[model samples]
Target: MNKFKKSKEIKKIKKIHFMLFFIAFIIFIFLSFQNEEDILKKLDENVTFESIHYTGTLEIIRNNNKIIKTFECWAKNDLFLIIFKNPEDNGVKYLKKDGNLYVYFPSADDVLTISKSMMKQGFMGSDISNEDITRNRKLLDDYSIVSFNKIIEKDNIFYELTLQAKTKDVPYFMQKLIINSDFVAIKTEQYDLAKRLVKTIIVDEIKKFGSRYYPVKVTIQDGIKTSYKTIFSITDVSFNIPIDPKIFTIQNLYNK
Candidate 1:
């Protein structure tokens, strides 16, 4: 009788342990699924602004805070028309389409297509690149969210979103975007195929243009080059203005 009682007690303990483990496993799966669902909801929310036009002056600085380049930019939708206004490269025009880019030199009167390998290269010795300027923001159309979380910056008020490329042709296979409640992209990190950090862009000096806020200044840093910093400042801005579609074409580069 004593042996039988001891055996029964051991069986009860084993049963309890099994039940506890099963409960924990269920909770873990539930939480993981919930987190994924929340991220998808956030990404699906409306975040686009009304159609607008903007013009700004960009200043580029290199290592040692030396002024390296400057340009005047006119932009609408995903297209930007730039004229190098300083360092004797003025009146040049460039066009970015999808992930491809082209530059037209007035002196040569020729338009040259930029190679895909050169997309990561600096634009006219500035910190900005073809990818940075031509990044498509139609999140719902181009990419999908894999995960998202809030990141506390200096003020402890910011949100960071991580997105995985849905297609193989995307310029950067993985991307992390940081934005505030206002849907302004304060910072963005790009990753390559090996999941290595390639570039980081910081947007600051936000100002309200019309009813929406826009970043007036931006700084881009390459992880491979720690000492390099490219600062772009917007000196003038206009929003919600009319822009002709022809302005986005290469032929319109020379149009006032």
Candidate 2:
């Protein structure tokens, strides 16, 4: 009888240990999936927009000098309009509509329809490509996430992802992005067809209004001289604002 009681107690203890192990395994799996989803969701949220309006300055450094051009920009879906406010380039406007981009020059009194080849050119003499900002493509929709790796450095943890374009229409062929917990992209590297690093965009400042966080300041560096860096800073911004019907039309762009 004593032996039987000892055997029963040993079995009860073993069962409890098995149950605890199983629960731990389940918890680990749940946490792993939840983190993966969060990583993807934050990256996807950046490219999705309804309508946005921002007044900002575009500082283009060329010939060892920084040229500051102030402007107001409006974007809705894939359409965009940029109107310059600087004295020299004042009243100059760029409009993107129906998969085409057009620039209206007040001085020339002429509207030049930008071609596909021109998309690779600098936007308003800045390091930013016209294709980069005017393309209505979302990162998650146009690219496949190759790897989502969480890295720990010192006290902060950052999420990094390698993205490959799903279609040729996408802006960048390959991209590597590192973002922090606040869903702010700290660093982004753009690659070309040869997998060569083409451009690097670094976010310097981020501002939160209501429920959304926006990059208020960013610096862009291309495959150029160190003094050729371009800085973009926003003064004021609002999301999903009401827009006039004629604001996006080509006719409005000409008269604008």
Candidate 3:
């Protein structure tokens, strides 16, 4: 009778251990999927817009030298048009449509297609690259979340996400993204294929446009040049506005 009682007690303890392990496993899976979905939703919310119009001012600073450029931008779906308004770059235009980038030089009165090789180069001597302006895709489309966690710092809550590129075609192979509670990207650190940090983007301010929060001021820093940085400020912005389809056409690239 004593032996039977001991055996029963041992079995009961083993069952309890198994149940605890199962519960832990389920919780782990739930959190893993839940966090990924939450991050994806936040990213999509920030980027989604039927159409948008904004006036952007760019301040490029290299060491002690600074240059300012202003432009009017309109974007819808995969199409966007940028027209420089500053005197130095006046009438110069860039149009992105059907996965291709086209530039119109006002002085030459010509439109030229930009090749993929040129996308990595600086845009008009600014720290920002051509790709940076033309890339309209969501980050999750090219990246897989490696890990994510909610962190609190300086009385603000942020979601820190580690992401790895799904393929080698992406410029940044890895990224550490920080998004605030408003679903706005507060900062992003981009890494190369070798896991070396290549660039960083920080959002300085955000404003609400209708129901969405948009970044009004941002700074981009290239890893190769510590002294080089670009500050992009959006002075006027409107989202979900009706835009004419002809505005994004190649023929309209040179039109005012």
Candidate 4:
């Protein structure tokens, strides 16, 4: 009887251990999924603005020369218009609409169409190219979220989102976006078709305006050039305000 009782007790202990392990495993899976979903929600909210109008300073550094120009930009969805305020091209206007880009020259009294090759030249001498601006689409739409990992540095914790492009026509083949706990993008690594790092954008500051989050100051650095970088800072940011649709038309580029 003593031997039988001891055997029964051993079996009961083994069953309890198995149940505890199973419960922990289930909870771990649930938490993992929940965390990823929460991160995606925050990212979507941060980038998708209803409308934005702001004045910004664009600083370009190349070799030993530094050029600074201030501009006002208005954007709604995929369309945007930027009017340079100073430094020789004061009246220059850049407009992007309906999958096309154009530049209006006030001095020449003409509007020039822009293409991919022209976009590669950069936007208003800044590191932000036409391709970069027009990629207004959501990150999840273009790339697949492959991994989610927590990074602990010092006393701060962050989540790193690794993305791989789903299509060949994407501007970046791979990107690693580092976001804070609040889901604000702190930095991104942009890669080319050959899997070469081409550009890195670091968000210096973010401002909250009436429940909307905007990156007020950002630095875009050229990966290959290393020394070349462009700092963009915005002021007087207004969001979700009414804007005339006609203003985005090509004819309106000269008319209004």
Candidate 5:
């Protein structure tokens, strides 16, 4: 009877150990899957613009304070229809369609097409170039999030996300983006192949337009020599406004 009781106690101990191990394995698998699903959901929710249109005046500064240049810009979608109203150059327009970009230079009476090599060049000596404007990649489409953490901004809170490109065509392949909880990208840091800081973009003066928040002022700082800053102050902005597709054509660039 004593031997039988001992045997029964040993079996019970073994069963309990096995059950605990099994439960731990199941819990690990569940947590891993949940984490993956959360990442995909966050990427899907990153960029969600039904439609956007805005007109704003811009000023480009140097060394964070010196006024380098200024311009009045009108943009729709990813296209700049009217540029170079202030400063010097007149009636210059930048058009981007189907991933191809072209510049209409009214001052030179010539239309110069933009090549992939020139994508990094500044637009009219300003901090923002053609790539910065047109290469607005959707997080789900081109990048994979490596990590996400909280960051405190001056007036609000944000998530600092480290992302790496999943494709070769992405211009800013490796970047760290500061995205607000509402999915607004308030800041971005781009790096070059040598892991050097290439550019830093800051969005400020956020104002409520319709039901969404829009940045009325934007500043892009180049980390290289001749630091440039571009400031955009919105005069009028409306989302889902009636815009004809023809307004995005290259022919419309020269149209009065």
Candidate 6:
């Protein structure tokens, strides 16, 4: 009788330990899924904007020479217009509407369409590409998260995501995005289908606009040619502002 009682007590204790372990395992799985979902939500909020108006300064460095250009840009949803404000490029307009990119030259009074093949080419001889300027699609729109991990450095926390392109229309086949606690991507690495790194973009400085944080200073570098780089600075910016829809139309591009 004494032996039987001891055996029963040991079994009960073992069962309790197993139940505790199972509960902990379930909580861990739930938190894993929850963290991924929360991070995605934060990322979407960081990049989504109703309307954005900004003045940009591009400092393009090639070999040893530097060129400076300025432009005023307005974007609403999938439509955007970039008008060069510099003396040399004044009146040059780039418009993206209905998924097509068009360039308007005031001198010739002509509108030229940009082919998809040229999307990867440098924009205005800078490290940034035409697609980089006109792409308003969200990351999740064209990519699926293959894997992700949370990283803690000192007091800062970051989430690193490996994204695989879901559609062929995207510029990069694979991308690595490192986002900070604010859900802003601090660094992005673009890779080709061959798994070769093509480009890297880093947010050097960020600024707070109202209640939101935005990258005011960015550096883009060519992975193939390390000597080539571009520093893009947002001189002034306004987000979620009212913008005229007609401003994004091709007809408006030809105007003035």
The prediction achieving the highest TM-score against the true structure is 3
Model 1, range 1-256, lDDT digits (tens) per residue? 9999999999999999999999989998778756544543443332234334444455554456666456666566566667777657877877765556879888888788888788877777766777666775555455676776766778765667787888876777788887775556778898887999877889877876555666778877876877777777767566646767677787776554
What is residue 40's positional error in candidate 4, in angstroms? Answer: 3.0
- Scored against the true structure, residue 225 in model 3 reaches a CA lDDT of 90
Quote the positional error of residue 1 for candidate 6 in Å.
20
- Where does model 6 exceed 4 Å of error? 1-30
Order by lDDT, highest first:
6, 3, 4, 2, 1, 5
What TM-score goes with each of the models? 0.70, 0.82, 0.89, 0.84, 0.74, 0.86
Question: For residues 205-239, could you state the per-residue lDDT of candidate 6 as single tens digits?
Answer: 98877767788999999999999999999877889
- Model 4 pairs in collision: none
- Candidate 1 similarity to native, TM-score: 0.70
Candidate 5 local lDDT, 1-256, one digit each (tens): 9999999999999999999999999998778655543544553443335445556566767665754343444445555455556556657777777777888887676778899899878777677776876775556677776776766768776777777778777766678877775556778887765667778878886776555666677777776754566775666666665667787787777775
Per residue, candidate 4 scores C-alpha lDDT tens digits across 1-256 of: 9999999999999999999999999999888866776787778887788788999899899978899999888889888888888868877888888888889998877899897777667887778877887667777778877888889999788989888899987878999889886678899998988889989999999987767677889999998999899999999988878888777877776763
Highest lDDT: which candidate? 6
After TM-score superposition, the amount by which residue 135's alpha carbon in candidate 3 deviates from its true location, in angstroms, is 1.8
lDDT of 2: 0.83
lDDT of 4 at 31: 85
10 residues in a row with least lDDT, candidate 4: 247-256
Between candidates 2 and 4, the lDDT winner:
4
Please give the CA lDDT of all the candidate structures. Answer: 0.69, 0.83, 0.88, 0.85, 0.68, 0.89
After TM-score superposition, the amount by which residue 190's alpha carbon in candidate 3 deviates from its true location, in angstroms, is: 0.8
Worst 10 residues of 3 by lDDT: 34-43
- Choose 3 or 5, whichever is better by TM-score: 3
Runs of candidate 4 with Cα error greater than 4 angstroms are: 1-34
For candidate 2, lDDT tens digit of each residue in 1-256?
9999999999999999999999999998778756765776775575356888999899998767889999999988778888999998999999888888889988778889999889999998999998887765556678777778888889788989888898887667898999887777789999987888888999999888676677889999885466688999997788888877478877786684
